[model samples]
Target: MSNLERDPQEIRCGTEAGERSEVLAGREVPLGGPRAMKVSRTLPNVHRRMIGAWCFVDAYGPEVAAMRVPPHPHTGLQTVSWLVEGEVLHRDSLGSLQRVRPGQLNLMTAGRGISHSEESREEVLHGVQLWVALPGDRRHVEPGFEHHADLPVVSRPGFTATVVMGAFGGALSPATTHSPLVAAQLAVDGPAEIPLDPAYEHGLLLLDGEVEPLTAGPLLYLPPGRDALRLSGRGRVLLIGGEPFGEEIVMWWNFVGRSHDEIAAFRKEWMEGEGFGVVEGFDGTPLPAPALPTTRLKPRGRAR
Candidate 1:
């Protein structure tokens, strides 16, 4: 399972967001090439490393360019591809070839290990790519992928929400999930009321608009224990949350591992040709692993 495990240190899940709500401005990261794109990373930051079981969050541009990422390796997490505009073609080691479009989802489970590639098919592509760390038991499961073209949605007066993952407003996604998480795409044309999961820590990222009456820029994080939120505006946003990941996890480049040595081993194997074997039919240069930091990776879960 790539040695990714939960920290033995017990951090109580659903820790309150505290009395202060945070407005986070994501760091700008540019993905280069002729088809270059910029993204914002909210999680895994110095201020907050994670929200619920979600450890990695990347909100990419509505850019018009060809993607060049070749088949790459991942472990201990599930990649959730949710597109708000444009399209992405996903190819994985499990022989899954799927095209992700607006309002569609592509979920890849990197249990033991998996390799996948994403290529843009449209002139412009806009989406959010997120990672859900696996629980200890599920981290070792076989690699797999699933696509949900049709998901459940709730339509009210000026509010509409699509339950992308987990159950929301009596709607559930067909895509498989390893943890108790909720991912939804919400749009508000005017005043909107949405139900929230009180048991989870939630956050919102404006794809193009704002949260009603709030003056936040683009991101608003609501700590766990809120029953609902009212929205009175015209915009699009992504709603993501779940039970907080109680354990710690170490991440480097594309791989998430349990320990420093474990991550080093994974990097060595992938770059030195020992792990994450060839993904057939994928023709492109794979991204190289970055150098490990001088300081040891922080421990999250218990040592394997």
Candidate 2:
């Protein structure tokens, strides 16, 4: 989904030191207008910015609501769409039209630029929309889209892990990733231990039920050096991590660029219908880019 805020804040993101585990709570943000659906934004928090290459994270509804996001532009990022409940129809500039349901993944690579829309006829929608900041070398690659209906699943004695992206439990997902990242959905039945890569910093978001040492509405961030995670509870959670994103990024509205001039140019291109192509199937008109801030955008290191 797009960052529909009228006055979006510019975020300068870089790597941070995480020596220990921390629980970071999310602030609620509305998606669109007055009746917009509110999502719990956890990734770009004040306490922590980027978790590896995984930059933006928004977890939304198991409640009754309709999602109608108009066609919007994106660049220097990849959108990872995962649903736990309900269904959503996705339309993009590449002429790809697909419906993503629970257990399925919709990965869109907005390498240079791309436009897309998401709509759901279902009464209730529940899912998480994530953005992976593309590294410097691959940021300008051609944009594309992928939909995976069957992903690898690792079933242990106490839990079942669905590998949404990257490698987990000796199983790897087919979804393409630009970095050494890992994303999985863990359905914990009782006590379970999850192995981890000591090189990557990880974060866990509780989706449902009660997980020991983890409550809903907050993300549990585990810094590098941990080899495993132990949990004894019945619940579902999303685990995401990777090698810390080393480069600084300026994120304003829907575009992720390097500087204020670059972002302003992107906005100008989108407004003039230049780089990001037309999204054909969406009924509504494309979303207009929000006005830039009065001052020049500045880059800052990661939040610690």
Over 208-282, each residue of candidate 2 has an lDDT whose tens digit, in order, gives 889887998888899888889899899899999999888888899988878899999999999999999999978
RMSD of model 1, in Å? Answer: 5.0
Alpha carbon lDDT of each predicted model: 0.73, 0.90
Instruction: Write down the RMSD of all candidates, one decimal each.
Output: 5.0, 1.0
For residue 185, model 1's alpha carbon misses the true position, in angstroms, by 0.4
Residue 77 alpha-carbon offset, candidate 2, angstroms: 0.4
Off by over 4 Å in 1: 1-19, 210-217, 300-304
Q: Which ten residues in a row have the lowest lDDT in candidate 2?
A: 12-21
Task: Give candidate 2 regions above 4 Å deviation.
Answer: none
Looking at model 1, the pairs that clash are 6-301, 6-302, 7-300, 7-301, 7-302, 8-301, 8-302, 248-300, 248-301
Clashing pairs in 2: none
